[model samples]
Structure formats: C-alpha cells, structure tokens
Target chain A: MVTEFTPWQSLGGGVLIGLAAVLLMALHGRILGATGILGGLMRFNDPADWRLRAALLAGMASGPLVLLGLTGQVPAVDIPISNLAIVLGGVIVGVGVSYGGGCTSGHGICGNARFSRRSMVATASFMVTAFATVYVTRHLIGG
Target chain B: MRLLTAFAIGLVFGVGIAISGMMNPAKVLNFFDLAGTWDPSLAFVMGGGLLVAIPGYRMVLGGPYPTFEPRFQLPDTRVIDRRLVLGSGVFGIGWGISGFCPGGALPALGTGKPEVFLFVTALIGGLLLARGIQSRGLRTKAST
Candidate 1:
C-alpha cells in the first residue's frame, strides 16, 4: 500500500534525530551512528564504553515501547521482504557499514551535515546504488 | 547519570524513527523505487535530521570538551579511498533489497519483527567476519 505524505511528522522526526545527534556529541565526544554504537558495544571496550553503549542500545530497544504507550500503534510494516533477503541484506550491511565506517545515519545524515567530503561522496554513491537496486528489483526482477 | 541520558536519547531516537516511518520497509523501499512509485519522505527525514545536527555540531565544537567525556572522539580520517566507495556500494544494494539500514533496523526489532532479528544476527556475523579478515591481514602485514 502506498503511504501518504507526512511532511510534518517526518520533519519533526528528523529534528529529533538532529537533537539526538547533538545531545550525544555534547554529552560525550562521539558521533551518533547506530551501526558504530552497536559495533563498539559488541567489540571489546572499557567498562565505561560498555555501560554507555549498552544503555544506548537498551534505550533504543525501549523506544518503540514508549511510542506504543503514547500512541498505541506504530506505522505498520507491510513489505514483502523474504527471510533470505533479510539475511543477505543484514550481512551486506554489516560488512559494508563496518568497512565503510558508517551507514545512512553516519554518512548520509551526520557526516554530510558536517560538510565532510568523504561523507558527501559516500552518500551520493549509496543513494544512486539504492535507487538502481530498487528499480532493478521492483521493475525488472518483478519482486 | 550518563547512562540515564543515553537511555533517554535512545528512546527519543526510537520514537523519531517510528514517527518518521523509517521502520516501515515498504516506505523505505519506495524511496529507492525511482522507476516505479517513488517516495521522498525519507528525504524530508534526512533534511530534518541535518537541520539541527549541522548547527548542533557547531555549538558542540566550540566547547572545550564534551560534557561527560574527557575529549571528543570524532573520526579524523579524510581519505576517500577504495574502502569507503566499495563498502558503500555494497551497503546501498543491501539497503535497497531489504529496506533497512543499521540505524533503521536496530530499533525495528522492538516492534516484534522476527525477520529483523534474523537480519541483526547476520549483520553481527558479517561484522565479526570482517574483523576476522582485517586481523589476519594485520597479522600478515606485521610478520612481513
């Protein structure tokens, strides 16, 4: 089902993201990339690193619950992604994000905002490829 | 105190992601479907995120140090090398196919999507595997 335009909510959400990024930077000298945060949490780190990152993950996991408590429903997930697709996507994303050193939020959002040249190029590359992949999968591949 | 703040911000991000419809794969996938029905909502989401982050980062940079930390731990590497480009290309393909990035997918599991759990598992595996290869390369380089 085609979703309707939600300009206001989307923008507001974006603001929250920005706010969160700022907060993270201000509170600790760190950029707020979920992938990086999760990865750091996974790898060996100091006690302080583990504590902060674990709290962040726990908070992220609890966010949906908080929204559900307030609004009683979230946007429904209505996509036809298969199990294989999910696994493949995850593996690629894991390796790619790790290798590239960032993901959508890191490069596309935060890095670009900071006028980082590498982030700018990375964002452009990924957006183009994503668009191409979708075109091929949806239109040509017929999935 | 720091932990509390982390939890609070995480909650905020989760709410924001949900409200922005970032968790909905169909909506996310449609953003990439340029040839078919395209959805540009994510553009607004990114725009909104940048709106605050740009200035927010500036103010933070002015400060001598982070509020809770001894020093700012920002990435300093400026090289636009093969690793960034090739890795991003692979990431983009996966993003189009599954409609989930590390940021979007992580919070999504809270909504009880079993499929997302699978994605997370594989994602971790990929990360560990990459680490393994990198370490081996390091070992070989150091020996030589």
Candidate 2:
C-alpha cells in the first residue's frame, strides 16, 4: 500500500502525545501505556484505579468527536488486513503486551524517554520484528 | 481532578494519533516496509515525542512527588528478563501483521469499526491469557 508521508502532521501529533504523557506523569504519576491501562481495567484492583482507566478510555473513545470539531469530520481508518488476520494479530499483541509489560506508548514513548534500558531493548526488539514481518508479508508472501 | 486530567490527556493522545494517521493500519504497515512504499513519518512521531518527553520527564521527575499522586508509579524492575524481549518480539510480529499497536488501536475505536472492536476483543483475550499464565506460573513457584 502506497501510504503518503505525513511528516508535519505526524510531528504535530507526536508533540501532542508527548504532552499527554508528561501530563499523565505530572498529575497521576503514572505511565501511560495503552495496553497496561486496558488490562488494569479488566483486573479492577481498586475502584480508584478502575475509574482512572475508565475515564482515560472514555476520553479516547470520544477523541473522534474532538477530531470532528477540529477537522470538520471524524477521520477515516483503513484496515487493509482480513478479519482473521486482525483477530490473530490482536490476540498476539494482547499476549505480547501482557508479557512485555507495554506496547508502543509505554515502551516506545514513555519508557524510552526516561532512558530505561529495558524499554529501549523492548522497543528495539519489537521494531526489528515489525520490520521483518512487514518485509515478509508485503514483499515476500505478497499478503 | 485526577480523573479529569487523565481524560484530557487521553483526548490529546487520541487526537495526536488521529492527526498523525497512526490509527490507520495500512499507513503503519507501510512504515515498517522499508523496501516498499515506506513512510518515514513514524520516525518523526517517535522523534518528536522524545524531543518533548525527555525534557518533560527530567523536569517532572526531578520533583519529589507529582501534583496529585503520592509518588510516581514508575516501573521498578531493572532486570531485562526474557519475558520482555520474547513478548515484545511476539507483539511486534502481531503489530507488523496487522499494523495496529495498542496505542493506535485504542484511539481508532472512536471510528466505530467492527474490525477495530474485533481486534481489541482478541487483544483483550490475549492479555487475559497471558495474565493467567503468569499467575499460574507464580502459583507453581509458590507451591514449589
């Protein structure tokens, strides 16, 4: 798939995300890992923890509205893979994050920023595999 | 107040993902495809995030405590165990296969696509399965 290179938009979005991460640390004193937050919700160790996660998730769910207000429409998301692939991918990612302790947000953004060796290693590990996976799928198998 | 701040932060994060087009799996996949139609925008996103966050973390963490919380709930483990590497590799394969990381997937839910819901459901199931395995391992360790 020929995706357009979005430097400016991506950079702007990155800044916003960075801001959010900082704010989460500043206020809640928590790391903003998307999968960790979701998994925490399922565990529901405490009402306060659940509430915090729920509020963040609810805000995430409502983000399209914010996009609508800003861009005059809810952005369209394209899923190029099949339903089966999506499910398989999701399950793998779920287990991976549970074992890895973070995904893109946790390790990629928050952990790396803090200069944690573990987060850096985790980021590099995933990135290399992701590159190899894409190479295999798009180039080799032609999926 | 904490909840409100968390919500606002989530909003910002979701908007960032949307604006950067990370919510689209195809775009993300293309980023990984170095040989074919590779989009280098994701690099900028990571760079831009680090540009701000590195300094921000330094400033905030310099303090004894955060504004609302008693202390930072940062990860305390220093050991980079097998679980971290192997699990990350597995997650990376899944991400490359689908182009939907947890961060992108969560915000994409706003689009109200059945596929997103499906992927998320499967992801949740995976998380549960992993947790079960970990707890079981712990139980065995305890028994031993």
Candidate 3:
C-alpha cells in the first residue's frame, strides 16, 4: 500500500519554505528567487550584491544539513540516471532558467507569491512540460 | 505590516512543505518513479498549494491597491507564446531526467550528496546559456 502524506507534515514544509522566502525578502528587500540568486552571482560585479548572493546560496546549501543534524535522517532520494546525465540535466535547467527569467523557486514560489502574470504562465508551462516529459521519457522512451 | 505579514505567510508555507513530505527529496523522487513504484505526493503538494493560494488570492484581490510596490506581481502576457512553450519544454525534460527541479534541488544540496553538486553545476550552465542568448537578442534588436 502507498503511504499517505500527513497534512500536518506537509503544512510544516510549506511553512519553512514560505518563511525562508519571506526572511530573505524582509532582510534584503529581495525575493528568494533561486535563479535570480544564482544569476546575480554570475552577472553582477558589485561587491554588495555578490556578498548577499553568496550568503543566500550558502543558506540554501546549509538548510538540509541543519535539518539532517536535527532530524538525524537525511531525506531519501533515488535517481536512476548516471552522474553525467545528472550534470547534463542541470545544464539544461540552467539554460531554461535563463530563458524563462527565473528558476522554479523564483518563478514558482516568489513570482507566484507576488501574483505576477508572467510567473503564473511560466509556472504552468514548467509544470506542464515536466509532466509531459515524465510521461514521454518513462513511457515512450523507457528511460 | 507588509514585512510581518510576509513572514507569517512564509512560515505557513514552510510548514506545509515540511509536513507534506515534499521537503523530503526521497518522497519527491518516488513520485517520479513510474515503472517500479509511483508516489503521488507531488499531486498532493500541488493540490495543497492551490488550496491555500486560492483563498489567499481572493483575500489579496479584495484589498485596496497598495501605495508602495504590491506584495504580488502578476505576469503581463496573455498568450502562450513560443518562449513559454520552449522554456517549459526544456525545463520538463530536465526535471524528468534528473528528478530535481529547482525547489527540490536547493534543499537536496543540504544532504552533501555529490550528485547535488553535479546537478547544480549544470543548472548554472543552463542559466548562463539563457543569459547569453538574451543579451545577444538584445544586442541584435539594438542594432536593428
């Protein structure tokens, strides 16, 4: 039988994500768009912006670690693809973020939070594509 | 008021993820696996997000326009243009193959898994390529 997700657990996760986004915005006056944070690191030469971007990245990277330390169990993950495929996949995502003007976090979370019409379209497009891709790859290509 | 409200809302959002098991990459990856075992946690996540957002959206719309920047910024375009279609296609392919969309990817890095690093590198490469294309497009328009 498939295990059901508890509503309380789901609510907690949402609360963390929402708080993190809000904290980022409240302190820096910037939205916690992962793509923007990553993009700023690549494009901006300004020291202040760079420092803040680095910190944001660092925080995200450390978040799971903190969770692990507290919970004593890392979340389970099973990816069938090889490491090389994973890297290539990341490259493609980077490209998409560039083209789309934001990553899922930026567009999906903060953008949606702000109710940007573009974000709505982008998020929908991304979700649809993701759904379609999964269907095709797993069903058609048998990957 | 805005800052406090934002924080409060965000807290709720985070709690939702934590509770839903969406914060757990294993749960997310399980959702992606179709052939062996399929988990429908993702559907639940989306359902939950929409459920909260719909009511929250109604509340926001009912309020007066803010003097400063509004808390939400809606997209301006009405059409499902080429960029939207193409970008989404690319994103989906990547997500399908990797099982790590941006939201999950960020949190996954916390595990200190080597795979996360690889995923992140490629994600950056994708972003850079997009920026280059955008800049080139801008330059071409300027020249024209």
Please name the candidate that would achieve the greatest TM-score relative to the true structure: 2
Model 1 ranges off by over 4 Å: none
| TM-score to native of every candidate shown | 0.96, 0.97, 0.76
Instruction: Give the alpha carbon lDDT tens digit for every residue of B1-144 in model 2.
Output: 888988998999998888887788988998998898888888888887888899999999998898998999999998899999999999999999888998988988988989999989999999999989999999999999
Question: Which candidate gets the maximum DockQ versus the true structure?
Answer: 2
Each prediction's Cα lDDT score? 0.84, 0.90, 0.62
Q: Which stretches of candidate 2 lie over 4 Å from their true place?
A: none
Top model by lDDT, which number?
A: 2
Q: Score the docking of each candidate (DockQ).
A: 0.78, 0.85, 0.34
Q: After TM-score superposition, what is the CA distance of residue B111 in candidate 2 from its true location, in Å?
A: 1.0
* Model 3 complex DockQ against the native: 0.34
| Tens digit of per-residue lDDT, candidate 1, span B1-144 | 999999888877877887887878888888787766777888899999999999999889888999898998878999999999988888898888888888887778788878878888988888887888889999999999
For TM-score, candidate 1 versus 2, the one ahead is 2
Per-residue error for B75 in candidate 1, Å, reads 0.5
- Candidate 3 RMSD to the real structure: 4.7
List TM-score (chain A only) for every prediction.
0.93, 0.96, 0.87
